[model samples]
Structure formats: structure tokens, C-alpha cells
Target chain A: MQSIERLVLLGTGLISGSFALALKRARLVKRVVGVGRNIENLERALELGVVDEVSTDAAQAVRGADLVLLGTPVGQMGRLMQQIAPNLPVDCVVTDGGSTKQDVCALFRENLPRHLAMCVPGHPIAGSDLSGASAAQFGLYEGRRVVLTPLPENDLLVVEWVRQLWVSCGATVYEMSAEQHDGIFSAVSHAPHLLSFAYMNSVLDRYNAEQCLDFAASGFRDFTRIAGSHPDMWRDIALANRDSVLGDLKANVAQLNHLIQLLESGRGDELTGFIQRASRARIEWGKPKKG
Target chain B: MQSIERLVLLGTGLISGSFALALKRARLVKRVVGVGRNIENLERALELGVVDEVSTDAAQAVRGADLVLLGTPVGQMGRLMQQIAPNLPVDCVVTDGGSTKQDVCALFRENLPRHLAMCVPGHPIAGSDLSGASAAQFGLYEGRRVVLTPLPENDLLVVEWVRQLWVSCGATVYEMSAEQHDGIFSAVSHAPHLLSFAYMNSVLDRYNAEQCLDFAASGFRDFTRIAGSHPDMWRDIALANRDSVLGDLKANVAQLNHLIQLLESGRGDELTGFIQRASRARIEWGKPKKG
Candidate 1:
């Protein structure tokens, strides 16, 4: 395929930096400009050779760029899109690495309305608790899944190019509508994060929280692992996907209330059945797929 | 340390089997008799040399035993204590690997009234998702923590004997009241498990359950890891530690309700503060501590 002559990364972090590294190894990009608010992170990106150059200016960095990737948190993407809009090349295919997509699709419509045909919204399913340029690795996306939500007005050619580039990075790309993407992710990802945060806060609210934390072992570790996620990014997600996340959170509260009733009334058999169903389903889900 | 002339394991599983293996390796046990309802697990215990002999009769196995470790679920421990009480040597010291100590203490009081002076209820903080006789390892307790709640009627000599044995197995043991042990474990271990189970069940309740599971990534996997735990064992724990577990569940529900109010009102700054506090605390708790 054709090479990306100039690639501008809006945030020099794990997801975007890894993408840039993988594409460079595939010989798919010529020059990369890493832009971020954090000078240290941008410098690290440069030191690691994740980019040909580093810039503190989003607008200046997007000048003459053929592909502009918005990799900042969802809350900041709209502002970045606005900053780069005036200088963006007319035919540059714009995309974002936002976890929640519908809000991003709206950002494109609001800030880059004229560039809708060249815009694609995507989420790369790769993250540990780690973040920033230091966490970037070329193999991060190998065998990982990327979901792309394309606009109706988007050019088919641009969408296909984006898909092919992700494929070149050893990622399996799947296409879905922005609405579906947000709903599915809220169920599997966003709500769980919010729930973890809620659980952590509850534990902290306890009078013996210090004692509780002191004795926390493996179960608490895994259950609350995501409670340590970046706050601003998650705050944006919770608001952006408000309806679905609210639904799931409400459903969880309902489940907890029902469980309380079981415990209070001493319904051992029903309690066992409830636990058995969930345990069986989780075991089934955890099993290796036959195919 | 005087070697245990005979070591009796009431149930051939991870906790008790590993104890036997560790004691054998330390030359602290001259013989180990594994007793269980499941013949296969007992046979596997013998095959793995976790036991010198296997029996389906708890009473017979406890005959002439100097040390008896109750390793089954707390629900089964009562019946096993009653069975072994008929034949246990007068000087034999009894301990348990029950996760909840208060209930096991009550069980000992009710079933082994004559043996209270020799009873010690314990919990070993070592386990993965794995169980069964094959999951036992001599090194399982290495660098791990064990909590022992000794009955007021217990002899200091017997308690010291138990503590030394665990230290030989490479464990650091702590002493606490059964009430304190139950309260702490309910906070850190039992409640998180039920929350996971409740969350999994909530997801399964959704119409798009399969679709949600299809796209579940790392966050969901870690948050729900304990949901796949053995159902009956967890059921017993929840019931056994009902009061503290109920308090935690209720506290979590209150937290979620407040979170829902925040989400419903669209209080972005307040939401950020909530997440920020949780995020900060979790990050702090997850950091490696220095002496």
C-alpha cells in the first residue's frame, strides 16, 4: 500500500506511540511528529525514537500532515480537534483513539464537520495500568483487537486505508457503528471501571479501611485493579456514555440489594443458585475457545 | 521442635495438603493420614505423596493422631469435628484452615467441647484459582501469611507448636481474636468475592449478555476473576461471615447509590473528585511498601 508520508500523533502515549512504532517497522510511515501537553512525555517519545520530532503545538504539528491521530483523553480530544482543524490538510484522514466513540463521532461533527468524510473513530484494546511514552512497545498491538466506527459520510477509501494500516500493525480490525461501540464497551469496560472506582471509594469510606487494606490479598487485588485508572479519562467516559453506564451501574446496585435480601433472610438455596450461575458462566467464559 | 507423631488431614485439598507436605519436608511430621469424602482426591493425595495413607473415615484417620488439620469448607468442618471427636487422642492438638474463624470457633465449641483447649483456627493466605490435592505444594506457604485464632481454652504449648510448624513451612503467622479475623477477612476477601459474583450475575441478566462477554477485555477479566471461584465454598463463606459481609455489601450499595445520583445530576467536577480520590487511594495502596 501507499506510505503515510507525514503522521501527526496528538498524544505521545502508549496507544499512539505503539501504533507509530509498529507502522514505522512495517515501513508504512516516513516521519512522525509527537505532540502532547507533557513536555517530559513528548521528550521521552523522541528519545525512544517513537517519533522523528516532538512538538508542543498541535496545530503546527498537523500542518501538511497526511494522517492526524487524536490520542488524548476523550475530554481533551474536541479541543485538540479544534486546534488542528484550521491547519489540517484538506485530504488528511483524521481519526482518534478514544475509548468511547459516539462522543468522538460528535466531536468530529462539531469541530471537524467539514472533514467528516476523512474521519474514523477507533479504540485499540490494549492497556495495562501503565501509561505514557515509557509504556509504549511495538508489540503492544500484536494480536490485539481494534474497533473502528466509521461515519456515514466518510469515504470508503479512507476507512479501508485506516483498517489496512491497523492490520499492518498486527492488529485485527473490526468495524461497527459508533453507537454500538459505545454500548458494548459500556457494558464490558466502562461500567466495570466505574464500579471498581465505586467499590474502592466505599472501602475508603470504612472506619477500618486501613485494617481492611492491610489484609487485602489476591481477590481484592484483581477486583480493584482498574480502580487505579486515570481519573480524568474515566470521568470523560462516564459522562460521554452516561445512559448505558447508568443502566449498568443501576443494575449492579439492584443485584447487590437482592443479594442483601438473600443474606438477611437466610435464603441459602437461592444464594447458592445465584452464585452457581455466575460462577458457571465465568468459568465458561474463561475457558479457551475451541475454534 | 518435637515432631508430630501422626498428622491427620480432614480434607485432602490445597490448604491442608500443602501443610502436610511442608511439615513432611521439614521433618516435623512422621506420618500424614488424608481423609476426604471424594475417593479420587484422597487417591491423588496418596499418589502425590501428600499423605502416607488415605481414608474415607475421619474418625478412623484421627485415631492416635497428634495433629489434625481441618481443610474442608467451613460447612463441612462441623460434621468432621464431630466425627473425629469420638476417636481423637486426648493430647492431640486440632487446628483448621477455614477462611472465616468465628464460625469455625463456634463449630469447635459446639462439636469438640472436650477438645477446645487444643483447638486453633487458622487461615493461610495462599491460593490461586486452583484447588484439589494436586494443587498442593511444599512451597505454597513460602513467603505467605497465616492467621491463627487460638481458643481461650488452648494450651500455650500447642499454640506455640502450631506457630513453629507454620514458620518451618516458610510462613509468617499472626495471632488475633476469631472475631477480628472474621471482620478483617470479610472486608478484604469475602465481600469482594460476592461483589464479583453479583456483578457477573448482573451481566448475565442482561439481554445482550453473550454480546457483552464476547467483547470483555482485561478490565472485565480482572474484576471478575474471583467470580469463577468454587460456588459452594463461597456460599459457605458468605453465610458463615454473614454479618460483616452484609455490612460491606450494604456499604457498597450506598456508595453506588450516591454515585448514581452524581451521574444523574451530571455533576462533572464532583464526579471527577470522587474518581480522583478512589484513584489516588488505590494507587497508594498498590505501591510497594518499604520497611
Candidate 2:
């Protein structure tokens, strides 16, 4: 095993940038090297003290690194893996910060040389909509959940090392199938975002029709604020996890339709019970996790 | 009008408490009488300087008031109006800070005396779930929107006076039909709350089933935090504006279902377009309004 004298993080956006900061803070790694398409972002990462060095060449960045984190968007991961897979040294642990694990793992399996047993597909469920290294903060992963989906053929040491990385960043690790991860996330995160986006559109349409946008208050602000998320990133997420997200969308619609039908039927008592049950459940389950 | 000496605010919660602060800041009223059932809340409001005085007796508090705001939950408005209606002086301008206007206005029309032309139904689109007068802060209404729904036969001077009061508090006032007001709010505010509540319930169910609660991150926090809102207040809102909320619920369900079906059919282009449109619309509508 090559000693991890240097760490190469691909695509230093929020997650990678945060990982860089956490690694530096924990003194887990000696040198942090950030690689991204945007030179400005690479410069910002260095300025923010998130990385010890910056590089634009994907292959050169990963050539001698003991650890490489594919932190690019899911859609862009395939191309990134293709560029870095050949240069990745033997016994070097490789992981990712992608939301969807199965596809990223598949990409690595297809592209990486057979000598690499260290590739693991992982996801850290700790991020804000804000992108780029500038938005990265130290506590981003504090007390958050990290899921590692390891291939059966992959060495257990790689999985453990990947887990340790997130743990150092203050994440609680979990083991799960990539399919399960995708489905569960689609239900919780993707569906809610899509709903928020669509709801904002409807309100904006109505307000624009009546020229009431200026009359909008904090209520509107609170509901649609998440709609301001990075469009390109979300676009990629929605498309990459299309199947699972679609399933969640169906469930969400069914739930809302049931609510609407009950209301249309003037079933106040049932509607009240439904909402009451939902409210009680949410109040009980929605407490924040410790960082 | 009788000499304005004292001001009494009923139900010293978020809106009332903020108004109390605004009134104190403006020095418009000589004294603030806070009436509520929770003694702790009353004391806390006093401790927080949200009110000059606190009381539990609805009638006693309104006896000498020149201006009184009924700041109780909408469901309790009818009963509270009955208790305070007979005690209000002839010259007192009785206005409410309830969200649902039509029902509250209907209650007032049936209960209030003819001389109380100052009885106005108000819906201030400002506030957070953190309730009670202690949550009150000055500048709460700055750049917020306040809607006043008055009956055609109601005194115009009284309506203008109520409008002027919110104006003084830095809110932009708009006049509209109670139906229109409820419809708009149901779409923008009430439905969003219900969605948040329901989504949080789903998250909780998953947590209970598989222990995923510990893994929730900023995305889940941002989406479900609002689910911790006051259940009683939401119950009142859902019950009072049942029909309009139901309409919005159905519309939301349809929108969600349409997106889901498109994704299920693998129509990436259409889904992308939909999200892009929604994102653009939300971006345009997301300008910050006052707290």
C-alpha cells in the first residue's frame, strides 16, 4: 500500500471543499491537492485554506496520490473517472462524494485498471445548496450521515479507509446497498426539492398574473427559498437518479392527491385527522441530529 | 374618537407581540395590555418587554382600550370576539390579526355591534413558528405584507385607520376579498406548511423503520424544520380555510403527479424543462421580503 503522503480531491465543490477543510483540520492527510475545471475555484480553495495545492490535470493530480475522492457532479463523474483511472497508482484508496453510488461505482469498475481494488462508492449526506469551495465550511459534515456501498470484490481496507475519512469529518457511517441509498434519498431529498420548486413556480405564476410579486412576504420567502438551489447541479441530480426520483414523485403525488380528494369531499374530520397524524409524526421525528 | 390612552393586545403571540413592540417603538399607545391563557407566556412577554401589562380577563382588558387587536388563533376568534365584543367601548377600533379573514369577518359580522365599524379582519404575512410575545421583536413588519378584508358595508374610515396602523408598522397594505385572500394564502402559505408537515412525517416514518433520523443533514433540516410549527395554529388554519386549502392541495398533487409520470416515462427533456422553468420562476420570485 502506498503511504497517503498526498490527497487528490476531484471537483472541489461544496462536498470536496468541505472534505479538504476537514482533512486539514484533523491532520489526517499531509498535503491536499484540489483539481477542478474552474481555475477560479481552484484559486478560491487555496485562498480559503481548504487545499495545500491545486491542479487542472486530472491524471497528474491522481498519479501518485494515496487517496482520490471523485467529488464532481454525478453526470460528470464518468468522464472524470475515465481521465484518472489509468494514472491511479496501485493500492491507492479511491472513494467519492456523489449522491448516487451505484452508477459511480459502475463507472469506476468499468474504467479503472484491474490492479485497483481500492475503489469504493460512497456518499456523505451533508451539504447545502450552495456550491463551490467558497461555500464550504468546516462543520458541514459534523454529525451528518455517511453511507458507503462497497463492492463485494473490493478490499475491506479500502472501505474502512473511506469510512475513516468521513468519520474524521464528523460523520456517522452506515453500510447499505447503492439501490437502497438511491431510493431512500429520492424519497426524502429529491422529492421534497422537486415539490418546493414546483410549488414556487405555481405561486410565481399566480403572482405574476396579478402583479402581486412585490406584495410577497416572508411566508412566500420561506416556502420557495430552497428553489434558489444550483440549477445545473439539481438538473444533473434529477436526471441521474431519474428512476428513484420518479418513484418518489409518484408517492408524493398520491399522498397529496389523497389529501385533496378528502378535502374536495368535504371530509373535514378525516382531513383533520390526516394532518394531525402527519403533524404529530413530523414533530416527533424531525428533531435535528447532533453535529 | 375618544382620547387614546391605553392599547390592549389579545393573544400576545408572534404577530401581536411584534405589533406591541412596534407600537411601543412608535409611542402610539400609552399602555399595552396583553391578555392570554398562558401565564408563563404573559410573564415572559412582560419580561421580554413585549407588553407593558398582562392580563387573563378578556373583558377587563378591553374595557378602556381605544385600539385593541384580537391576536388569538383563528379558531378561537369567534368565541373570543363574543367575550370581548360587548365590553368594547363605542369608539374603540377592534381589529384582529388572524390569518383566515372570511371566517373571522363572518364571526365579527354576526357578533359585533353596529357601532364597532372599526372591526377589521387582518392577515399579516409575517412571522415564524416560534410563538408567544417573547418571540416578538421590533421591525417584524418592515417590508412585510398585511391584507385587510373588510365588508362593503363596514366603515371606510375604520378600515383606513387599521390600514394606517399596519402602514406605520412598515407593512405594505393590500385590500382584497376574503375569498381571494384565503385562496392566495392557501396556495402560498397553508399548502406549503401542510406539505412540510406531510414530508416530515414521511421522514419520520423512514427513521422509525430503519433508524435514518441520525443521518439527516442540512437539506432535511431546511425542508423539515418548519414541520416543527405550532400544531394548534396550523389546525386552526386548516380547519378555517378548508375549501381553499383543499383546492390548492389538489393542484399541487396534480403538478407533482405530472412531473412523476414524465420521469417514469423517461422523458428527461420534459422534466428538465419543467424544473428549469420552475427554477427560473422561483429565482425571480425569491427576492427577500421583511421578516
Per residue, candidate 2 scores C-alpha lDDT tens digits across B233-271 of 776787789887876677677677777676667676777
Give lDDT: candidate 1, residue B26.
94
Q: Among these predicted structures, which one has the highest DockQ?
A: 1
Deviating ranges (above 4 Å) for candidate 2: A1-3, A25-33, A43-56, A113-116, A137-139, A207-213, A286-291, B1-3, B37-61, B137-139, B170-172, B205-210, B287-291
Candidate 1 local lDDT, B42-112, one digit each (tens): 89999999999999999888889999999999999988888888898999999999899989999999999
Query: Which candidate number has the best lDDT?
Result: 1
lDDT of 2: 0.77
- Compared with the true structure, what per-residue lDDT tens digits does model 1 show for residues A1-291? 988999999998999999999999999999999999899988889999999999999999998899998988999998998898899999999988899998999999999999899999999988679999989899999988999999999999999999999999999999998888888889889999998999898888888889889889889999999999999989999999999899999999999999999999999999999999999999999998676
For model 2, the DockQ equals 0.45
Consecutive 10-residue window with the lowest summed lDDT within model 1 chain A: A202-211
Clashes of 2: 0
